[model samples]
Structure formats: structure tokens, C-alpha cells
Target: MRILAITDLHGNYSKIIPLLQKSGEIDLVLIAGDLTNFGPDEKAEKLIDMFESPVLAIPGNCDPKSLLDVLERRDINLHNSSRTIGDVTFIGLGGSNPTPFNTPFELEEDEIESNLETLINEAEKTDNVSVLLTHAPPHCTLDEVPAGNVGCRSIAKFMDRMDLIVCGHIHEARGVMEFGKSIVVNPGMGSDGYGALIDINVDETPKIDVQLIKA
Candidate 1:
């Protein structure tokens, strides 16, 4: 399956069209978070309407929790949920783990853990490969800040079981890393025209390929 992963758009709808145009033909689009910058639900709905392919998305720290309603109305909200597409099962956890700025969708560590556990349990029941889509990166992986690593420790501990993790919160920490059996990717900020392309081949032995793209 070919997938396009984008995150932290922060209400730059103009970039969405160009980004999709550059992405070419893709089977699915996974939006990590931050679709709006404290904007209204219309902003999120408008962005979802622009996509031709099926989109699975979650709300980011800068986005209001109400954005989920828009995503739900469009049938694309992946927050704290799981969806199976082809041979892949995607589990999503939106929002950050408490930031100094007090973003609109920040969640506590315990809440994150509970949500993730439920999703993980559901993922375990599926025969497809498990992919984690989270707004916050795993601790000490792609979530490092100059001050320190401000990622979800629970996510890191649960990394070994997942096939891939697509996350983006810390812009400067954008890149790819391998932890245990899972591959972690941070697509950076979409408003800045940064994203990642992922290809998963389920024939014979499953193969995963990823590339960072800038528009």
C-alpha cells in the first residue's frame, strides 16, 4: 500500500492542494495532527474535502478538540481509534502530552496511556500489520527538544509491537528512526511543505519503504 503522511499543517489550506498535487497517486493519506491553529471546525472540514483519497486524521496540540466533530462529520477522524485498510491496521492517538504553552488539545500521560492501551488491544486482534499514527513521537526518538525529550514514554515502551509509527510534534526533530521492530517517522510540519511517503509491500515477506518529501 502506498501512503502519504503529513502533519502540523496549522491551517495553511493553500499548501494542501499543492502538497497533494506533488504526492502523485497514493492509496491513502495519514494526517498526524495540527490541521488548524486554534481555528474553527470549518477549517478542518475544508481541508478534508480537498483530499481525493481516503484520509485518516487526528487533531493536534494547536487544534481544538472540537475539530474531531468536523473530522467525524467527514468520516476521517482517527483519534484514539483503529481502522483496517487492506493488510494494514492503523491506530491513532492525537494531541500532545502537556506542553508549556498549554495547547488546546494537550492530554496527560495517563490519559495517553489508557487510550493507547485500548487501541493496542484492538490492533492485536487484527491479522493485518499494525501501524501507529500519533501526534507525539515516542520519547527520545523523534520528539527531542533542545530542553529535553518531551515525548510519550508509554509510546516508546509499546513500540516493539508495531510495524510502523507516523508521528510529528517537534518540528526540528523530523526524521526517521528504527526502534526494535518498528520504524518511526516524523513528517515535520505540512504548512512548511514537508511530508513523508510510505510504501508497504505485503507480497511474500512484508517490506516497508519510506522517503521524506518537500514541496
Candidate 2:
């Protein structure tokens, strides 16, 4: 399966059109969060309408909780939810853990942990490859800032069971990492013309290929 992963749009919907146009063929679009810059739900709707392929998305710290309603109206909200595409199971968790900035969609660590645990359990029940989609990266992994790590420790611990994790919150920390058999990726900010293309081969020997692209 081929997937186009983007994050931290922050209201730069215009960038997406050209990006998708040049991305060749994509089976799915995975959006991490921050569709709007602390903006209205309308902005999120406008962005979602631009996509032709199936989209699975979640709200970011800058986006209002009402954005969830818009995504639901479009049948694309992946927050605290799971979806099966081909042989892959995608689980989504939006918003960031509490931040010093106290963004509009911040959540407590325990709340984040609880939500993820429930979703992970559900995904494990299926026989599909599991992918975790979140706005925040796992603690001390790809979520490090200049000061220190501000990621969810619970998330890091859970990584052992996942096949892949797509996240973006720390823009500068954009990159890929490996934990056990899982691949963790931060595709950076789509508003900044950065994204990731992931190819998963689920054959006799399963493998994952990822590439950072500029759009």
C-alpha cells in the first residue's frame, strides 16, 4: 500500500493542491493535524474538499474541537478512531499533550494514554498491519525540542506493538526512527511544502519504505 502522509498544515491549504498533483499515485492520505492556524472549522472543511483520494485526519492543538464536527460531516475524522484500508489498520489520535503554550486542543497525558490504549486494543483484534496516526510523536524519540523531550512516554512504550507511527508536532524534529519492528515518522509541515511518501509491502517478507518529499 502506498500512503501520502502530511501534517501541521496550519491553514496553508493552497500548498496541498500542487503537492498532491505531483505525488504520482497514492492509495491513501494521512493527515496528522493542525489543519488550521487556530482558525475556524470552515478552513478545515475547505482543505478536506480538495482531496480526491480517501483521507483520514485528526485535529491539532491549533484547531478548534469543532473541527471534529466538520471532519465527521465529511466522514474523514480519524481522531480516537480506527479504520481498515487494504491490509493495514490505521488508528488516529489528534491534539497534543498539554503544552506550555496551552494550545486550544491540548490534552492531559493520562487522557491521551487512555484513548490510545483503547484504540490499540481494538486494532490488535484485527489481523491487519497497524499504523498509528497522531499529532504528537512518542516521548524522547522524534518529539524532542531544543530544550528537551516533550512527547508522550506512554506512546513510546506502546511503539513496540505497532508497525508504523505517523506524527508531526515538533516541526524541527521531522525525520524517521525505528523502535523494535515499528517505523516512526514525522512528515513535518505540509504548509511548508514538506511531506512523506510511505510504501508498505505486505508479501512473504514485509517491508516499509519511506521518503521525504518537497511539495
Candidate 3:
């Protein structure tokens, strides 16, 4: 199926506008996190209004609980939930490990790990190929920063072989990587108006093709 995966949008609508226009014949739009500058309902609503396909979003470090609450009102599905479309099972986790900034949507290492374990188990029960969508990168994989310190070792340990791992939070490492039979992609900065389009086949070898879309 064709999917448009993005993250760290931080309220940039110009980029999103083009992305929505270019996304044709897409079955789903997966948003990793940072949809809003903080946690504004209107921003999330505006994004939801632009899409024709089903959108799955998770809250990022900057996302406010109020935003999540408002999303519930809009009947939008939030993370900590699982959804299946076509031959793929899309699992989402919001927020990231605690950072120096004390962001609003921070999660502890253990918290993320435990939650990830549960998600993994749940995905295993499904008959479809698994795809993990998260706001933080998994350890030394695609989660590196310009400072050279890789983030979330626990995440890497919990990351088993999956069809694809789409993440954000590390803006510099905005690209794709093939690791341990899984295609890991970080769409860079939603704030910068850049993201990725991924096409995947869930059967057999689970082929994945990613296209970088920039404004």
C-alpha cells in the first residue's frame, strides 16, 4: 500500500499543503509527532481536514494533553492505539524519552520500553506485517543527533525485525536506513516542510520504497 509518513511538523502548514496535494492514491497518512507547535487543537484539526485518507497521529514532546483531549473530541485516533489497513498493522507510540528541555510530551526510558514491549506483542498477534510509528528514533539507528550522542538504547533493544520503523525527533538524520531486515525512515522536519512517501508490499520480502518530499 502507499503511505505518506511524516513527523515533527511543529505547525508548518505550507509544507503540509503540498504534501496533501501530491499524495495521490495513498491509503494512509502516518504522522509520527510534533503536529503542532505545542498542543493546539485548531492546528491538528486543520491538518485532519486536509487529508482524504485515514490519518494516524501520535503526540510529540511538544504536544499538549489538551491537544490530545481535543483530538478525542474530533474523533481522531491518537497513539497508544493500534489500527490496521490493508495488509499492514500500524502501531503508534507518542512522545519521547525525557530531555533536557523538560518537554511536555516526555516519556521516561523505562516507560517507552515497557510500552513498546506491549506494542510488539500486540502486533505479533495480528496477521499483517508490522509497522512501528514513533516520535523518537530507536537508539544508534536513525536516531542520531548533530551532537553525536545517539538517543534511546532501550528503544533499539525492543525493536525487533519489522517491515518498517518510521520515526522522527532527530531532524538531522532525516533519511532512510536498512537495518536488521527492517526499513527505518525519519522524514526530517515537519517544521521545515519536508517529509517522505513510502510504498510498501506486506507480503514475502516486504519491499519498501521511500521518496523524500521537500518544499
Number of clashing residue pairs in every model?
0, 0, 0
Could you tell me how far off, in angstroms, the CA of residue 17 lies in candidate 3 after the best superposition?
A: 1.9
Cα lDDT tens digits for candidate 1, 89-150: 99998988999998899998988988899899889887788899999999999887889999
Candidate 3 global CA lDDT score = 0.79
Please give, for residues 1-215, the per-residue lDDT of candidate 3 as tens digits: 88888888888766777776766678888888888888565788887787878788888888885677755675555577777777788877788877888888888888887887887788888777788888888888876666775567667875665778898988788888877767788988976777788888855354678898876
lDDT of 1: 0.89
In model 2, pairs of residues that clash are none
- Over 118-171, each residue of candidate 2 has an lDDT whose tens digit, in order, gives 999999998788999999899988887888999977688789889999999898
User: Quick one: ranking by lDDT, best first?
Assistant: 2, 1, 3
Per-candidate local distance difference test: 0.89, 0.89, 0.79
TM-score of each: 0.96, 0.96, 0.92
The TM-score, computed over Cα atoms with residue i paired to residue i, of candidate 2 is 0.96
Which residue pairs of candidate 3 clash?
none
- By lDDT, the better pick of 2 and 3 is 2
Worst 10 residues of 1 by lDDT: 201-210
